[model samples]
Target: MKTDGAEVLSKTVTQDEAAILDAWNVALLEGTSLQSGRIREAELQTQVKTVFGQLRDALASGGLDADAAGFASLRETLADISRSRAIQGFTPTDTANFVFSLKEPIFDALKRMPDGDATALAAGVWAAGKVLDRLGLQTMEVFLASREEVIGRQGQEIAELSTPVVRLWDGILALPLIGTLDSARTGVVMENLLQAIVDEEAEIAIIDITGVPTVDTLVAQHLLKTVAAARLMGADCIVSGIRPQIAQTMVHLGVELNVVSKATLADAFAVALKRTGRKVVRQQASTEGRR
Candidate 1:
């Protein structure tokens, strides 16, 4: 029977699995940060073994296409490795080297084939290169996707953290704005303020933008949206942080906040206090003070 290149290659790798795995490990350590202790020796060994074992099986089954049903398990394994490496802060090149590193060992094994299959060298090397390249590309794709997911989730977390709604009193809440207030931040601002309103049963929300450097038409529109959302939730809103420059800009832009506006967070808070039927009275000196 005439054994094909893939069959011959698979047989060679299976027969020299131990030696091939060692060579693969050496290649990975030399080319990657596996020694920096991101991944333990045992885990690294296991990963190499799993990938090689699957590769051998898939090649034997003529499953070279990465998307083929026969290679599904192998693709899943690669994806898992990619995601793990991505979370470990591995660079894209390092993550891909996990598969590409195996190329040296595999090709070395191919060259050592006995005279009987020596004629299979060219074909075997070509097939092996194509398959490994496909798998390496797959690993890179998954790594990038995992990194994107991590970034998007972290971005949302930071947005929420940046927009904190504090309870100033029993019926009043304050959302102190800082930095630029764009549409995206406005949405975050609105959600946080509304949720706090329900959570604190707040009747008034003071949006203190004293930290806001300037107010543009768009910024004003965003503020109006937030105020509208709060009003719909039965909570009145106060726009604070008005400066000489900002007040002038709003006037020229014909931007009407409609709700009460204050010059500072303290002014907004004081309004919040009185409207909530609360006050801050200073204690007078007693006989102890006189003594």
Candidate 2:
């Protein structure tokens, strides 16, 4: 049905592949942002060759209907390119342009075909454009999906980074939470605190929520759950940063924090030190008379 596409692919892959690649790269870089500096010319040429080889084989077998089973390899190659570009911080438009920009080069190459007539060349260009447009859309879909995965993984990393359990002293750990305590973050908080307790053989944990903007029923519940989990791990928890507003709100909401509460992290730390039978003492200078 699309004999023109077959002819175009056969000729381009065999004769003018290098020229088309050069033209395609010019178009790609022109459309790309400054982020393209991360990609080198040799790497781009290698990828172009790989993608064109697959597309040539697919077009030979399936003509312009490259979405058929015969073109699975071509689709797979495009998807891999999209995913790699996404991880490399390429924009969606830039990634899709990697395929779309090839249209101009392909049409230009078709014009240089020795046996190409005007009508035949027009047919070939149209067929190639249609297939590339479809592939461009597929690339965009994969790029968006990969970018979303990257964002989700980054969010998880940030959550893990923020919820650090620090050893304040022997048998004492401090978990300073600095944001909203949702169910997800609560789970992380609990896991980190419990693991730290086991690793440090900690007897006391101080959860300082001075950075938490508000204290509501749900937040209170999450705190309680963390406290319960730590107790199970043989670590008593002290909820610090109990501001007057939060304490009053907890009372009105009838949220009972069964664990001990303190008004500040220092107060909680003092209590933790006392519970662990420790105190910070200053060294006093000896009062000796000097002649």
Candidate 3:
């Protein structure tokens, strides 16, 4: 079942490795990370050698099935490269090209093989191209999966960082929202607010959304969910930062918050302080004492 090209290509790489490496390095360095200095030349050369060695070994064993035992190391090597490239922000095309580019050097080597005839060379080149194509596709798949995982992790980290709970007083906490509120972020807000309530024994929480660009029915619902969750934690939530435009939108949408709301964080804080039986008192200036 082995293609004539596998035997030819394997022998070409095994006997003429130096030539193959030189040719491949020239093509790889022309417009790649090595020339741009993003990746160290030595590191790139090492990865090339590792993959080239594995391909030679796998072809010598007579199979290009990526799942086959002989190709295990090659698969893992490509996977590592794909994941690294993804994390480094390289596109799938850039990552897959690492494997596809090998075809040119390999085809060139096969052409120079003295024992190879036209028919055998044709078959070998065709088979080799197929193998490289499959490997390139594999790298792309891994790159996409890794990229998605990184994006998801970053999203969670951003959500956690955005929803900060600050203790304004012994029993008062403040959460300033700066962006759109969605279900996923609302969950994070609730978790943070509830944890802060438990940790600080807070009786009042002010959710300031002055930085939110817009407020729709869904955003209002997401906010309500957070408020309800905080109330369940034995802490009443006061929504703040209701811009005039946002208030009008909420009124038009008929969104019933059913909770205390204020036009500014300061107003909400003052209300919270009053509800907590505390009020800020300005000391009157003592003219007699100054004189």
lDDT of 3 by residue, 213-269 (tens): 989889988888888888888899999999998899889888777889999999999
Poorest lDDT segment (10 consecutive residues) of candidate 1: 282-291
Overall lDDT per candidate, in order of appearance: 0.85, 0.84, 0.86
- Go through the candidates in order and give the clash count of each: 0, 0, 1
lDDT of 2 by residue, 1-291 (tens): 435556665666567878887887788667654345868767877788889888777776756776798789889988988898899888777788888888888888888888866777877787877889899999999999999999999999999999999998899899999888899999998888998899999999999998888889899989988998888888899989887987888899898988899999889999999987887765555645331
Candidate 2 lDDT (Cα, 0 to 1): 0.84
Q: Point out where model 1 deviates above 4 Å.
A: 1-4, 116-119, 179-185, 284-291
TM-score of each: 0.87, 0.84, 0.88
Between prediction 2 and prediction 3, which has the larger lDDT? 3
Scanning candidate 3 in windows of ten residues, the lowest lDDT window is 282-291
State how far residue 84 of model 3 sits from its true place (Å).
1.6
> Tens digits of per-residue lDDT for model 1 on 1-291?
554767777787888888889999899878756766788888987888888888878877774576788788899999999999999998898888889988888889888877646558877787788888999999999999999999999988887788899888898888888778888888888888898899999999998887788888888889989999999999999988788898998899898778899888889888888887877865656544431
Model 3: CA > 4 A from native: 1-3, 67-69, 90-94, 285-291
